[model samples]
Target: MTLMTFVYLIAGLILLVAGAEVLVRGAAKLAAQFGIPPLIIGLTVVAFGTSAPETAVSVQAALDGKGDLAIGNVVGSNIANVLFILGLTALIAPLIVSRQLIRLDVPIMIGASLLTMGLAWDGSLSKLDGAVLFGGILTYTAFLIVSSRKDKAAAEDDEFTKELGLDETPKPYGWVINAALVLGGLVLLVAGSNFLVEGAVNLARALGLSELVIGLTVVAIGTSLPELATSVMAAIRGERDIAVGNIVGSNIFNLLCVLGLASLVSPLPIQIAANALAFDFPVMIAVAVACLPIFFSGFRINRWEGLLFVVYYVAYTVYLVLFSTGKPVAEVFAAAMLGYVLPLTAVTLVVVAGRAWHKHGFTGDELKR
Candidate 1:
């Protein structure tokens, strides 16, 4: 590839990061000014702002008729958000799983993912399918907002207070300044996504790789950098709720908002690649379902669990590279993972979840801290 190609990728990444940072900061402040709970802000405003790059890039790719790139971007991003970003954040500090996430948001996320799979079963996403997905996001957001009102006790949590600076005095004209920042961030995201998509398509052609592979591996990770940064920083600051919530929220947003909008804007239905339907979609769904047992195990992600996540992410990425390059070892690796690692992990998680349930004597209404 030419030097200019690499330049585009690097420049695009820098802009995406800068844009997401600005957008999240402004949006969080704006939400706080309205007296929104910090967890709600993390799940909605911060999540949507950090996800702007995926929205921009996927929509741009759809308009260009590169449907695979668009689809791969959303799927890959969801995968990375959980496996890479959340894993890394937990490694930094074991994350506390908010009960709201387990009882509400995580289940919503799983449902959204299953809905995407069902919609894509026809191999194309029509405008009607887009409507269904987009509608889900609106409903989910409204539910979170309404439900948050009953959970004012969450506002008293140390992490929420520290994260949102709930006691700090608001500056005059804060809303106006925050609005400007949001707009400026949007402009940068649009520009950056354009560059990133163009560079990715060209690089795919040069390397004899499919646009889908490039989108899944390189572009997916690149676009998800914002979520990575937000989660890692939150974890470092001990804002455990925001750290975990951001990843889960962004995954839901990616599927519902990014993919739905892209499908709607496409002149024709976006095609779902056969491999993606058979493999990637199932993998994404498995990852989402896996969260239940892990999070239920004492309502926190331990460092050991975090390391497991990181290892799985690494193995997943390596498999993608090998498979894309037609390496014989790819099959062996897949077989090993399916035959041994996955089953072992599943059994281990079941035991952990059961032990936690028994130890806490959890009823339908209560979970011990």
Candidate 2:
């Protein structure tokens, strides 16, 4: 890679960190001042804000005619969100689950993910597919607003008035500052994505790796930095709701908003790569479904569980790298993943879904928080 590219890549990482910090803090303050419930802010504003990088990058990639990058970025991001971000955060502190997420967010996330997979299964995400995804975002946001209002009414008077000192009320300069932050954040996101994409492409070419491989491995992990920062910060602040919500919500947004919007700009035709279909997409589904055990088992993710997640993620990365480089050892990894891991994951999903139904009786009590 050229020296300039390295500089741009480093600069992009710095900007991504700075932008996410400003955006999160600003959104928190604004939500507090507006009397918006913490749950709503965590679900919508914080979730969408942190996902801005993926959105920008994916759209740019599509426009540049590198549609695989756009698709791979979103798919890879969802995997990273669950395996990497959630895993690391849980290691720091076990996440406490809210009933709201268990009932509403997690299921919705799964549905969206499955929907995306189904849409792309036909070998492309057309403009119509994009519209459907974007429509889901609109519907989900509206539901949150309506639900928050009803929740506000049913909440105990003290509950509504309880101050979360972590979130500051907006100051007179809040709009000005926030607008600047949002704008700056967008700029950095765009720049960082460009540099990262370019550098990644160059490195892949030099190493004789396919773009799809690079997208699934390096690009995916790199763009997931925002989720890592946001979730880790939320965990540090003891904001378990934000920590868990950020990952789940970002995954949803990455699939719907980011890929949805990107596909609208340019249809993403599937390349029929065996790794993507047989391995990567299935892994995405598996990692997403893996959440059920953690979320439903005890409504929390303990430190040991967190370590397990990290290990799974590391193993996943190693397998991908080895497979890409044509290593003989990859056959063992592939066989293990497909022959054992995939079926095990499927069984887990079925069992978890059944338990969720038995516990909640199809009425979704998990949503009652």
Give lDDT tens digits, candidate 1, residues 1-369. Answer: 898889989888888888877887777777788877677776576658778889988999999999999998999999888888888899899999877788878998999999999999999999999999999888888887776656654654445556556457788998998889888888888888889998998899888888988898799999998888888988988787788888998999999999999989999999999989988999899999999999989889888888898899899988887888899999999999999999999999999998887876455333533
Location of the lowest summed lDDT over 10 successive residues in candidate 2: 156-165
The TM-score, computed over Cα atoms with residue i paired to residue i, of candidate 1 is: 0.90
* lDDT scores in order: 0.86, 0.74
Give the winner by TM-score: 1
Residue 3's lDDT in candidate 2 = 76
Q: Which parts of model 2 have CA positions greater than 4 angstroms off?
A: 21-43, 152-178, 267-274, 340-369
lDDT of 1 at 61: 94
lDDT of 2 by residue, 140-208 (tens): 887876777676644422332342233344568776776776677667767777777777667777777
Query: Model 2 reaches what TM-score against the true structure?
Result: 0.82
